[model samples]
Target: MNKKLRKWFRGLTAGKAVHFLLALLWFGLTLFPLYFTVVSSLKLDNEIWDTMFQLPSIPQWENYFKAAETAGILSAIVNSVVISLGSVAIMIVCVMMSSYVIARRLIKRAKALNLYLLAALMIPLQGAIVPIVQMVGAVGGKNNFFVLMLIYVGLNISISSFILVGYIGGISREIDEAAAIDGCNLFQTIFRIIFPISMPGVATAAIVGFLNVYNELPIANVILTKTENRTISVALLAFQGDYQTSLSLIFASIVIVIIPILIFYLLCQEKVEHGLASGAIKG
Candidate 1:
């Protein structure tokens, strides 16, 4: 046992030891917030701040029930899901088609068009929220989820385009030729062949677009003025008030809000990782 321990210690080179320590640190950092939230969510209001780092004496499962009831969590979750999935679906379709066109240089001045679309990246959409709100108001589109979905798609277009274009560009032209020779039309070729081959990129863009739309607050808050139409981010504001706040409830709500997205990320994590790695290499 002593000899084995000595061998194991000797095997830990400086670089390996440093890396292990860093990874351990990162793991702790990543879990700490979740631990804090879980503990705080179970405690009394005063206990949350006072014993923040400690576990609750008695776990208050009622906090979840209270949060769900008070915040309309189910409704908000449903709204977020509908809008997020709808927005990402639309975004993926638009981004993939546009990216393919750009990547294949199929359209006139495709590079110029790509650059023009990408220019939106430099302009912060949040900075122009006044005009956006005005434009939506002018159209009488407030509380309309379809309009919000469109806005989400528009906001995400630039980054999605960048990612998809790079990934699609990396795909070989020979595949297009093969599809053509096999009697596939442009639409068929793109959807059947290119789309599958470039799924990693699509997954990457979808994840990004979903996260953006789901967590969006200012626009959702303004547009979805009705309590019934509110998304999770907007609904969270119910817990916070000017004079007093329910910190425990807020943590409970947070835990509920994060569960779906965490599940989503876990499901798509493999594809997303591949997409990012390939995109980096391709770019």
Candidate 2:
């Protein structure tokens, strides 16, 4: 009977191994396009098409430099960085402060404020495109990095604030009251005590906000008229045409754009998950 059971267990294990192998095959199939991009980026014009299906003979390290130099990508990279970081900075301050007030019930009319915040969250950015463009146009920040930063910040606030408020609400009220009894005012208690504790939630919100701003294309497309001010996502369009397609450069440029996001995720994903698991959501 024991030998029969052992044989059954081995059969189950073999079945699981087959399933795992199938899953891995599916994963590779999914990742094929991304792999093609990286490999194609390392090949030249004819080299790209002629050997489109072939692996790289030699790594094309110069594609990185060539793409940057040819596409005015240096300026785009700088613009993208400025816009992303600037948006993140503004988001951190406003969302953190707003979430704190909502979480702590600092406003006497908390219900009204909560309703307002919820209303804002429900209003999608795409729906506001018309008025947003007019406002941005009227304000005359066309093609400016500073203006793009403001546009990004205003657009992202609702969802970021909502998530942050939920995290903040999870924090125990006893801590706030304790700090108050110890001669700490609302500002001090918020900044000194609550804010530090909410760093994880704040990090999570900031990273999401940063990714949104960095990857933004529509608003940037409408607002950014100058080549110098265009974000990398917008600038990647430079490699496309009706007849002539620079597939190699397109692949290289895409790799350049994706690499930064991958790096940021690798570094900050731990902090983000840590904050989500803990109650440190508002600051």
Candidate 3:
């Protein structure tokens, strides 16, 4: 019995060792580009071409300063933050209300509405660019920040609502009944009771929506033609010239642009993961 137990323990240890090796390989592959970017961003323009992976002999921190000044990174950061947060707030409120109503079957055609929303998930945003651009122009929304915000909200609402619906369905209906018994109206019950319970789903939707809006390039590129109105992703174009691009400046700017989202994800990673798992299981 002791011999058998020892063999079992050995097998478990070997399995863990194999898993660790695989995880290390995956981590290296995932980290390589970011590491290369950071190292390249610090090299002098002349030095950058010397070795692909070698560490710079002398770090050129001035590349960041140049990138910031030339790219108008500060203004772009402000624009991205405002648009992303505003769109996320609008999306959450709209998605939560709509999802709750549908999940609870409060309306006669709730199923139909839910079906329609779910169907929209199959449509890619790329296909709608031309029509959206034309519509924005017809409505005189070109180069408008608020118009961009509205577009972000509209594009994200369907998926956010879909995620919330599944999670909201998993919540107890008795909670709504209880809220209603205590003199809560529809909006009150949803805001005070249901919304609080569905936070995991909300967190997931918020993160996803924020990332999409913040990193979105194509829509922002086409819609925001003015330099002053550009978001971070669109503003990166400043580093590119007709004949040549500034590699060091571009990479430095990329590092700056990536920091905020990386911090946000790190802070809320647990919530995001939990939300995704719960939504998937409930869905």
Candidate 4:
């Protein structure tokens, strides 16, 4: 038995070592481009090509600053931040309130409401974009922030509310009864009790919505006509159109466009992971 155990332990150690090496190689493959981008962003054009494989003598922090100027990077960043946050904020409000009402409110049409949201999940964004744009334009939403916010919120509602509602459903009914006994009305209970309890769902909605809103280009490119108002994703197009091209500057700006999203993911990855895990367990 001792000899058998020793053999098994040796085999497990060898397997683990092979697995570790494979994982490290894969990780390096994924990370090298990101490392290259960061390094490329910091180097002079000459340094980039001449010493392409070499690290910078001293880091060039000015690439982001220069790119920021040439690409109107600051203004584009502001527009992105505002739109991303605004969209997420609006999504959270509608999704939470709607999900809470459908879950906790004593409405007779609960089944119908659930069915409606599920149906919404099946509807393609591409199918709705034409009518949605026309409707918004008709409503004087051309170049309007409020209208854009409404559009983002509405488009996101199906997924966000579906997740929220599912989690709300999983929550203990006794919790609701206890809150009611403590003099909480539906509104009070939802805001004070349910939202806090279902925080994982809220975080899930936020991270997903933030990512989508940050990178979305089609609608922003089509409707956000004002150059000053264009989001980073759209603004990146201006660096090189067909008529004129600057490959280096364009890649430099592409590097700039990636930073904020990278920062957001790095900062919120822990929360996002936690939210997903907690929600999965609750669900």
Candidate 5:
């Protein structure tokens, strides 16, 4: 029995060691592109192709400034920030209120309404792009940032609501009753009591919404035709030409765009992880 137990323990240890090595390998693979982008961005365009891994003998810091100027990156960054933040803020408020009402069964047709909202998630945005574009044109909403914000909010509402619903369902009704007893109205109770408690769900929804709006290219490209109104994703196209492209400048632009997102993620990493985990378990 002792000999058999020793052999089993050895096998388990070996298995864990193999898994550890695989995880490291996967991590390296995942990080290689980002590492390459940083290194390549600093090298001259001519040297990029030749020296894939070598450090640049002379770092071209001006590549970033040149890329920014050529692409109107500052304006693009502003547009992206405004649109993403506005959409996320609006989405969170609307979704939280809708989810709260639905989860609490506050209305006569709550079940039906919940089902209808969830159904929206199944519909692909690509299928409705034509109609959306036509509607935007009819209202002169093309190239308008506010219109873009509305579009993003509408697109994200259903999924955000669904996630919030699952999380809201886990909250006890006693909290609502207690808040009411303290002379709080429905809106006040929800905002003061429930909203604070549901930060995990809110954070989860916000992160998802922000990413969706920030990285979305198809809709932004169609809606924002004007150069000044373009987001970073759309503005990146300015670096490409029909015959020749500035490879270093393009890489530098990529790095600049990536920095804000990376910083945001790092700052909110703990909250994001916690929010996702809590939402998954409770939702």
Candidate 6:
């Protein structure tokens, strides 16, 4: 074992050894928090701090049930899914059409309009909270999922357009000409030709928009006042009290809340990676 270890160590150059050790360090740093959360979730409330780094004597599987029931996690999950998915769907459609128009300069002053939309990226949501609340109240839309979804779509358009416009612009205009030559209308060309070719960008925008709406708390807290309309982020906030907090239950809820994001990422992982790679290279 010693001879093999020495041989292996000798085979690695100094830079490779340094990089390997640094990679291992980064891996451990990234993995430890998740390990801690899982371990803590399986422990008793008292056992959590007492044996912070140790395994629980017996797992507390009941914590998940208790957290889910007490926090209304299941319903919150539904609300989040509805709002996030709805918002992403609307944002994608709007941004895609707008981005295509901007990319192709189809509309007058398209560059000016693109710049105007991209300018929203610099405005923080908090800064506009008062105006948003006033606008929503003026329209008599409160505690409404549709309203919230629309707000999400509006907020996300800037970045989504920025990502997609650049991506769509990278595609050859000759394809559009070809589609035109084949007797396809403008909308038909966009749907059939540009849509498939720009899927990576769309995937990227969808993922970003979904994540933004799903995890957003400030706007949701302000607008989704009803218990039934509470999102997962708001539901998690309910776990905290003035005098008492359950760490184990919070950890369990954390685990539950992350499952959907994991599933979504797994589904869109390929497209997102390709989109990012294409953007980096093209940009």
Q: How close is every model to the real structure, measured as TM-score?
A: 0.94, 0.82, 0.91, 0.80, 0.89, 0.91
Candidate 4 to truth, TM:
0.80
Please provide, for model 3 over 1-283, each residue's C-alpha lDDT reduced to its tens digit, 9 standing for 90 to 100.
Answer: 9999889777777779799899999999999999999999998777777877999998899999999999899899999999999999988988988998898898999999999988888899899999999999999999998899999999988889878988998998899889989999999998889888889889999999999999999999999998999999999999899999899999999999999899999999999999888887886
Ranking by TM-score: 1, 3, 6, 5, 2, 4
Across 1-283, the per-residue lDDT of candidate 4 in tens digits comes to 9999889777777779799899999999999887777677677766777876678787777666666777687898788889889999988977887887776656879778878987987997788889988897888777777777778877778777767876787788899899999999878888898889888778888988888888887777777889888888887887677786544465678777787778878988887776666555654
Poorly placed runs, candidate 5 (over 4 Å): 1-12, 108-124
Arranged by lDDT, best first: 1, 3, 6, 5, 2, 4
Instruction: Evaluate all candidate structures by whole-model CA lDDT and list the values in order.
Output: 0.93, 0.83, 0.91, 0.79, 0.90, 0.90
* Selected candidate, larger TM-score, 4 vs 6: 6
Residue 38: error of model 5 in Å? 0.9
Candidate 3, position 157, lDDT: 85
Q: What is the lDDT, from 0 to 100, of the residue 195 in candidate 5?
A: 97
Model 5 / residue 224 / CA error / Å: 1.2
Could you give candidate 6's per-residue lDDT for residues 1-283 as a string of tens digits?
9999999988999999899999999999999999999999999889999999999999999999999998899999999999999999988888888989999999999999989988989998989899989999999888988988999999999988888888988999999999999999988998889989999988998998898888999889988888988999999988799999999999999999988798889999998888877755663
Which regions of candidate 2 fall more than 4 Å away from where they truly are? 1-30, 45-53, 108-124, 277-283
> How much is the lDDT of residue 85 in candidate 5?
100
lDDT of 2 by residue, 1-283 (tens): 9999889777777779799899999999989988889899998878887887788898788988878887888788788888899999987888888888987787898767867877887787789888878988798878777777887888888767766787889889999889989999877887799889878788888888888888888889889987777888888888888889787788888898888788989999998787666533333
TM-score, structure 2 vs. true: 0.82
**Candidate 5 structure quality by residue, lDDT tens digits, 1-283:** 9999889777777779799899999999999999999999999999998999998999999999999999988889889999999999988888888889998999989989889988998998898799889999999999998999999999998878777888888899999999999999989988899999989888888988998899888889999999889999999999889999999999999999989989998998887787777666775
The residue-level lDDT of candidate 3 at 187 comes to 97
Instruction: Report how far residue 73 has shifted in candidate 6, in Å.
Output: 0.5
Predicted structure 6: lDDT: 0.90
